[model samples]
Target: MSEHYEDDKSRAAKASFYHAYFSLKNILIGSYIVLSILVISIFAVVTSKVTEQIITEKENRAVINSLRNIDDRITLKLDNYGTVMNSLAYSESTQTLLKQASELSNQRQLELVNEVYYRMNEVNVTNTEINAIQLMDLSGKKYTLNNGNYYMEGLMDNYFESPLYDQVRSLNGGLFIDYSGAYSRDTNNLTLYRTINELRGTRPIGVIAMSIKKQALGSILFQDSDLPLTSLIDISGITVIDAQKELQGTESAISFNSFTDIASSFQTPLYGDNYFITYLKNKHYDYTLVNRAPIGSIYQDVAFIKKVNFYLILFNLLVVVIIAVFLSRTLVKPINELIGLMNRVRQGNLNIKMTNPPLNEIGILANNFNEMVTTLRNSVPLRKEQLIGKLLLGRTADSGLLQQAKELGLPAFDSAHGVAVVEINDRSNIDASGVSIDDVEILLQSELAAIHSSALLHILDARRVIMIVHGEDEDIVPYLHKMLNEQKNIPVTIGVGRFYASAEHIHESYLEALDALNYKHLFDRNGMIYINDIQAYVYSYEQLDVLEDGIVHAVKYMKEEELLSMIDKLFITFKEQFVSKEAMNRTIVNTYLKIFKLMSDRGIDLFGSEQSNIQVPSINNIHLHAGAHELKREFAAFLQSATRLIEERREKRMNETIAGAIEIIQSRYADNDLSAGNIAKELHISENYFSKLFKHETGVNFSQYVTTVRMEAAEKLLRQTGNKIGEIALQVGYNDANYFSLCFKGAFGVSPGKYREKQGN
Candidate 1:
């Protein structure tokens, strides 16, 4: 009885569990179907909205582009018309005709006016857009021609009476639009579009006006469409305001109010019962372009889009139903497996392999997934190694590995005994040929060759190349010399610093290299220099003062030969005291700084412009420890430029002084005691000093200058008066007649009698 009851209870429990499991499965399926419908509906609405926005934006752009195209065409036509008018109005023949017309008889004047009209008609006929051409004088008188026939009497005050006339007149030269009714002809209802251009002076001479056909402008507004559009309405709300149509045209009388009310009542682009109204603002005319498009006609495309969207939605729903069924079964397992693989990969275990079980398409997908993992596993190490190498060579800044390197306490330098900074001067001239080499490559090759060992090289910046060399050899000089000579074509300068014991002291070596390079200007052709060589070239500060005094003395005395000799002596003394490249460079750079400073103190600008306002790099930053030869060459070039500038300034000052002296001499030429000695005494200078100064300033001696001035006065007196030669000579500060005659002969290259006879007195 107990066994029977237990079996019955077990069967009942099994039945209940299966029934509940099936019910849960049905509930999950129903939830999925409802969620999927909601998601698909949301996606469809978003997609439709996005598509509509894109289409609307594209249409707006198309409209703007079309308007711009039309505006460009009209602008071009107006520009061409203005150019023709400008050419004719400023022509030499037109000026000549106008000039002749003023003085000619009434009959001749009429003929000349007719000729001018004929010329204008020819220009108009060539341009089909131009209906008529008219020329008007400043007095509001118009002379118009139509098909070579002249109309002289019925002159209208079109531009002269308009408010735009003064604005056009103010341009002085160039064309401006005159919106006033200037030349309104009857045929074709053509109204005047005057392009008034002024002559190249203060006065307004004439105006050029064209009668533009209204139909030509209307065609531009409407273009290839069946739509009705009216364009170029003025600020006063008038259509066809600046039109070329005559007063008799049917479209000319159409008021701006007729369209302005209808356009204003509708939202910018109003689609109405039969037509859609739209308007574009014309910036050139400061007006509006109004158009009316057939409403049902223009929106036919919009209606088609609606119909297409409805069918697309129905088709999309069918696709969604199939996609839901397929995705529900396949997505969960593949997605879970992919997540696991990604987690393993992220953890650096790229060896993770996915299993391919034969069940639907998941087997094929699993095979592809395993292949991807294998490729990634094989490539990661190689890429990481390559990336590390690139970072060490300064090709990249790998912050991750760099941080790791720092944390691991990796040595910044390999067992380097010393650091050297090698810089390539005139790097811009480097030949970039094989391997896309640049100035940096030239520096790298030169440094490696110089060290002749596996030294670490780094590009610090555009201007500096740094290297660390291992070993304790004190005589790195020979290697440096050979390296520089070998790479002479590159024109690189190597600055070697004092050897440091460890990597941490590399900064000290860097400073030494910089110091050595700074003193490079003291040397000649080979600029390879070492910082330790500077002590040999040290000099007392007093010696620099002596050098300054010597330079100034040479300049003041105007002794070029003596200056050259002094410079040679200084160079020889420097070479004797300091034989190394560093010493020579330091001396050269110091000398330049001293000279420039002296000039600055004396209020002399070495750069020709305002030196005070100019900012130069700090002197410490300037690489001076280049080889002695390079230092010397750079200094020499700088000195040459400075010397030329000084000479220019001196010449300008001398010219001013000479001009003043000449003015004084000319004003006091009648004074009998106006000799060189007397002039020197008056100016408070020695007679000899004055003579030298005068010759230097004017390329003439003081006595010769005085004689020349006196002779000029004598010639002027002889011409203006019936005076004897002796009297003229005496008046011009020549006392003794015989002495004056000799002076006169020297001054004129002839006797006073011949000079006076040559004057035709």
Candidate 2:
């Protein structure tokens, strides 16, 4: 009882320990999971925002510095061009040429043109970025030199409607720069127009318009940029010059008028969705130097960074998983092993040595556990014997006796108890093997151990082992009876007492066992003789004569099993509850006298049949037997002969029964829990006897037959059903799909799922 109680306690403890262990494991893994997600999210968001900030700030600064530098240099160049144009326009040579070109002879006009052209060439030497220098008069006459060519294109077709003519016509001083295309066809050029005035009267004479190739000016301003195009846009939003010629005729995507009012550089969308712009405005000229590029091209650097970050995160995640697994195993393995060792100790394996102690708290615990087990090993078994011995003898427990018993794995329950005594018969008289009965105790302990049950067995004397039991009773007494009866040394018998409430009443049960043990003399064979079993068979002496005619009638019909059952009842009454050995022998002889007289009245021959060993020993021989076992052997031989006659009656139906058993196996094969013993019970047959006939008729054991039937069914289901493999496995009575797959593969060389796929279903 104490053993079982302690077992339950240990089981509960183990359950709680594993609960904590698994919970802690999940928490640690979950922490890593949550932490990894948080880290990745935060890292990605922070990196993206910071990169955007840096890119914006850096791009802004670069646009400002590049535009400002270009603005300063271009402004200075324009001012220089203004100074040179003024110097040329007020020259005495220019007034002389303009005045003589219309008044002089053809020869003098040609000479005057040569003189003006040479003057213009000198101005070009000082300002090489000038593309074409032209002079136009109020009378529509024109003088032009392009790219410092001596053979210049003489142009001045119409000056009245040109922006250069109108803007310069209003300027009394300084240059008027026109970024708008000089002509619709010449879109890549812009003109700076300055009006030439009479120094004497301040009257405008002609407009000197310079058509500068915007590329030359842009090259000077934007030499440092990697951007594809940098250009100057006029107040009218027309692009003057671009490094890439594609935008030469295009209008500025951004409005220069909006930006010209600002004191600093700024950015805006340009060309709609295709481009972005950063611009610096020259308010003096209303010519903005703008840097524009495609958005995708600009963000290329950032995209590369994002890809690198993603790979880095993947590498870090892999490291985290590896470390998580390593740490979990390192921490959990030792504790799991310690738990394993502790369970072994709980299960009464005192010799098990706990191994691989770690160097921390668990190590200290391991050392303590080893010391504790060393102490328990020396005392537990001996103390258990003493504890049961004192209880069964009805001795009052001394102070701390209960505590000591509990420490040795006994529970201190106050109720529900019983006892059983098993006696090993003396083998000296049997001429059997010489093995000592005490040596069998080791084998009994293992056979009696249960999943969570407890009982204590003690050897009380040379031939008796007493078991003090508590809690539930199932097959303990019966299994012990079987083990004892099958012992090869000699006949052994068991006697079980009735269950009694109250722990202290176990002594009463112990006494009852002793009384029941004395009834063993009636059995004449190894068997269990429960007190209740004997009570069930109790009868009066007057009943013996009445039973004799019935017994003889059963024997005449060869009802062997029925007749033997009656004898068992009569003997239990005669020996266990009522008569002494001598009185029992007298009653037994008188019972046989009635049986023989009945046989005589029927005129049946008492001699044995030649077909059977149906011989009755003389009454003197039965009376002279030394023990119940030898006397019962004589009766058993007589019963065997009668059983042969019954077998003759059964021979005709033997094959039919065997075939019926096969049908039951086939029909029940789909039940995953089916077994041979349960099937025989349903068929109303003894399992032990049914097993032999099943094997003989089927060429396989019952379990093997069931497996074969299930396997065939599983194949049919796998081929025909559209169900999933795991679902089909369950339908065919396999609880585990993987095991079913393995078995199927072993039989058919293909897994169920693969086989179904092959059928194209």
Candidate 3:
């Protein structure tokens, strides 16, 4: 009985432990709650300490950056204004106007003022913030230019007598006044005053004043409404700008306590409220920028941050508790579901799916599994298509193809079969028509089914699809035409080959189909071409040689008419001789090659046409044409362009040659041997060609032109000096003095001596 009680107690303990182990969801939630509380408590303590420091540092950095930004903008704007003033002071026009200010007449001084007024107008227009520009000479006479009805009244007539003038004059730089009260309506006016001294000497010439609206300075301040106060104070403790316009020209509220640094931040009281102050001294101007904020706002931000951090920590702990429970339920469930899915896939069930899967690694595994199954499901048909492609290429054995075709539900092979290639004439046309290769294939399959013919279709590429049809007597051309008529939007060309007696020769029919398709240029035949219907012809090499020579000769000499006629004759000859397509291709290629060779041999730069931007047609462009008519048209256009280029080249060369001949004539007219023939020999041209070309270009025969040049020289000699006719004759390229006199008389209608005597008279 004692041993029985011990066994029962041991069983009870075992059952309790197993019961606790089974309730894992509750255990996990409880553990997470405890851990999150401890972690959040520790985190809160550490974060509170660090956050204050970080917030303080960040606020300081942001305030400093704002100060720098304001400083830079003010400095840049002020410097620009200063530069404009300097330009005016040192300008030649300004200097001249000022120097002659006293001695000039009324009109002259008015003219000078107009010059300076135009300069002032430009500055005022560009810097619309400036109110007025006033120029005062040494005698206190004022010249002012204003824009948009902004004129300064003389409320401060004693401005020159004030200490401000003395202050600006004492220093070499400009001085800024807070409010000049120059405008009667607006008392808050900021003016820049400087003495305009002679740039070359130190003598003071004039005082120039520029007035700006106070709001312009206010606009440059950092626009933060939270700040209680911000001000720009001069070194003399006067406020130049205040956010409140009433404080302008008043003494600053907060004292610096004599901190002599460029920048300082401290806590101070302003108007009974404790405030934090940040100040930066401007490097370019005699001003200090000061910003102040209430001390309560800073502590409020810190308190708000601490409160937000505590709430955030509590919210995170709650999320961790919820997540622990959720993961305890969901993590194992998805993994198990994934394992089951994988098993089903392993069992050859590719249609299984996991719905609303958890977003974790298991979800990725499930998606990949689905994709893998889909690929496996599609691989059979893909493999069958590949096998058919291989069969058409003669890369697969007939036995293997038959077995795979049977298993893959492909059309069975037959003893007599033929391959037809249906090529889309233009892929763009198909895209424009909203039809695809699949649509065309389905149409073809439906037509084949309608005709009760067994066939297999595979899209070879984007533009072409190949069909292997069973039976020797089945004619697929009519069905292809039917499909073409059904789909009027997509244009197609069908090349059907003769049926073979064995499957092994299917690739031969494929090749033959492609061959028939290429004959679209010769016999389009309404886009339905058959191998057996195409007629082969023998070409004579001698005939091709004659045609090629004619074409090349026309292109070489740039004869457009002859080239067109030759191109026409080429096709005509091909038709008359019934030349094969291959021979026709060879003929066209050989013609282009020979023309290109001629261009190379003659050093003709195809792109040397400066008069026209039309590029010479590339020789490779010939291969782009697929039809006889288009090829003929493009070839004609190409040859025409070539003719124009060659003509331009020849014209340029002829002009250069004529110019060279004229240069030789000018330099060698005194040689006495500068005949057209001698010059032509030097220019590497025949005398007749040179003479005719020269007359055509210069509107004069070579001999007459030469004689004209000589007579003009002789006439100059007679008028300018006392040289005799014989000496001038030798100087002007005439060996015989008597002949020179006769030639000169013919040119001038007077003998050389008579001309000289007439000129002397």
Candidate 4:
């Protein structure tokens, strides 16, 4: 309406610029002429809008196609450099020098260093785009080859930091290119960072940096234009490259920084004339390519044609003026009827109808307009409700919705906005009688004043209620909690979402409320939870995955003490991080189930004969899982029973292994080469593993068991066969008579001769 008023005022000023004629003939002629001019003006305005859209699309397409072609060329060039860098990365000798340049001897290093320099020279010859290549250690200390012939850089602070280098490090290992000043020495040159890793491992051992000079970049960097100036702007809006060296003043006229809300593709005005602009961003390097040309240059031919048509229309208007007078009278009659009907509609009435008056386009238009008015009147309430729903859900189109909301007088949504979720617990379910959902909503709205509420939106259900509130203070969350806590009539649980500054984030607040409500069991006594207080614990809960894996490993290995330590560690972390009680219960139960699954996969059962008397509680039984401490006690007992069963399983396997080893040893006992190592080798077990199992299963060390078997054989030979000590020693597996007599005496606490005499030989 304001725009319409301004247009009327503008026309009134234009009419005052003309002289008035009072003669009847001239007045009638002038009035018809003026009316015809108004129709022609409307035609021109509509034509201009269509032409503007077509021309804008045509120029934007032409410029963007050219920019994309240039972008593709640059990517191709950079890809070649990347391929070369990857080739050098896979070179085994280069990788070895990167890792152990300090470990090589001086003479060997010099010779090896010359070979690397020769290789680098060969690479430089192959790829001339590479201006310089330097290899630095992981600690950023530069290593020179052939006295700085190939690698010449010294230490760089913070391991070569710059805009591009920071991007490369954050991405781990990739081709890093910078038209921006990632290199300190030369901003004109593009810097490259290629992280080189060990040949056989994924560990990055060093970085190789290459510089490509701007001279090598050529005019292609700026698209090499002639008429319109071309420029390459960095991310910081600095013009780094200019194609038209003659038009260096392009910077003074156009500054992208002036348009902070610039779109990816948009036009900007320069000196009151539109400059057709297109946007192309480099996906790899992250700089914007802007192609700009004046709108006049693009539409010059169309402007000439429009001027010719306007002159022709003016000449025709003189001949058509008399005929237009008759037609205008006919057109104005139905239009007057339309004006009256519109006035009725503007006064809030849509029941008026258009009778069958004429068989022309005007009457048909009137009929369609009448139907449209009726439809709008019938759908008013439904549309308003839909808009309100959109506003509450925060799914509104901002400018349009905000304007409509203001006209409809919706509750203001601004900085201090929060959401509260109410859930009916067992106590609440038993006592929610005689209270309608509407009554509850009214109660909540009335109670919101304690929070200094300005507005509210609510959805109530039998089991749950969601309320969105707006307040003036930052203490809105605490006040809402206080109100809900003081409600003794309803034994409900409340979850309050954190406040947000805009209505668009209201959905985020609602999601927070829902998540907080999921942890209701955590605050059983308080019956309320605030998202901000436990948000950190929600993130730290992911660490439980590592803890669960540790528990599984200990349980699988039958390490009962280690398993207990892991459980304590899990609970300690939960306490330290202040993880909610619900989260703790859920994670522990999940981890315990995983432990049982691993044991079941190994064919160990918790309900087997060994565990028949043990009864594990279910998840719904809260008495057994009041908190982490109580849960830990119950879990420890279950783990102890599992450990005993696992130990029994291990013992059976250990007995079979030990019996097999003893059989192999006894069969070969008389052989003097028989020893624990040989016995373990015959049994096909690791020596260390066999020793531990032997000692654990037999209650004696490997060597001690072997010696006893040999000595017993020696005693039997001495007592039963009257063999000489030397012969008995040789029979038993000792190498000499003195050694055998010493062994026999060591076993009997006397010499072999005395033992033989005492046996009455």
Q: Each prediction's TM-score against the native?
A: 0.35, 0.34, 0.35, 0.36
The whole-model lDDT of each prediction reads 0.55, 0.65, 0.71, 0.64
After superposition, candidate 4 runs with Cα above 4 Å error: 1-41, 106-126, 143-166, 199-201, 223-228, 244-263, 267-276, 294-302, 315-761
The prediction achieving the highest TM-score against the true structure is 4
Off by over 4 Å in 1: 1-27, 96-101, 125-128, 148-155, 170-199, 226-230, 241-266, 269-282, 285-288, 294-299, 311-313, 316-721, 724-761
| lDDT per residue as tens, model 4, 531-636 | 8866454445546765776577567657788788888888777756767666677777777788778768656766768667766646576434434555677778
Q: Give the TM-score of candidate 1.
A: 0.35
lDDT per residue, candidate 2, 1-761, as tens digits? 99999999999999998888668777788788678877865676676666655565555555565566567668756755765576567666666555555776878766655666676666553545666777666676776655554222533445676555666677664577767665424665556777777644457777677766666577776676454467777767877777766766677666656674433444555556656567777766767777776767666666865765565465567664664486467646766787799898776678876677777545655665686577568757656765776677564344666666666778664557788887776557543565564765665676667534576787765677887777575467776667656744446777788888766677778878877776666655567777775553445555554344335545654567767866676565565564545656666566567656645544444564744445765878655654555665676566455545544533543487677787777787767888778878887899998899887765568876676567667766765677787887777678998987898786656787776665456
| Model 2, runs deviating above 4 Å | 1-40, 67-73, 95-116, 125-132, 136-155, 161-164, 180-185, 198-203, 218-225, 243-246, 252-273, 308-761
Give the clashing residue pairs of candidate 3, or none.
none
TM-score-based ranking, best first?
4, 1, 3, 2
Predicted candidate 1 versus true structure: per-residue lDDT over 582-679, tens digit per residue: 44445555666766775575457756565443333244634543343444444444555455555655567576546666777888887877777777
Against the true structure, candidate 2 has what lDDT?
Answer: 0.65
Q: CA shift at 504, candidate 4, in angstroms?
A: 37
lDDT of 1: 0.55
Consecutive 10-residue window with the lowest summed lDDT within model 1: 262-271
- Tens-digit per-residue lDDT, 1-761, candidate 3: 99999999999999998888757886788778777877876666666676566555545544655666667667656755665565567555677667777887889877877787777666442456777777777777777766557878652357676766777788554545434343223446677777787754568888777777767767878464433477888777777678777887777887855447788777787889998788888744677888877878756656875785677566676664664577567656776787788787665566677888777545655555565566557666656666776677564453467766665666556578888888887667679878888888888778777877667888865678898887743666666765585546567878888788766788788878877887777665347778887677666686677668767767765667878887998887766555665677777878767766776565566555643565445655555566677667766776677667666665665578887887887788888767999988998999899888998876579987788777767766876788777898899988899998888777666787776665443
Best by lDDT: 3
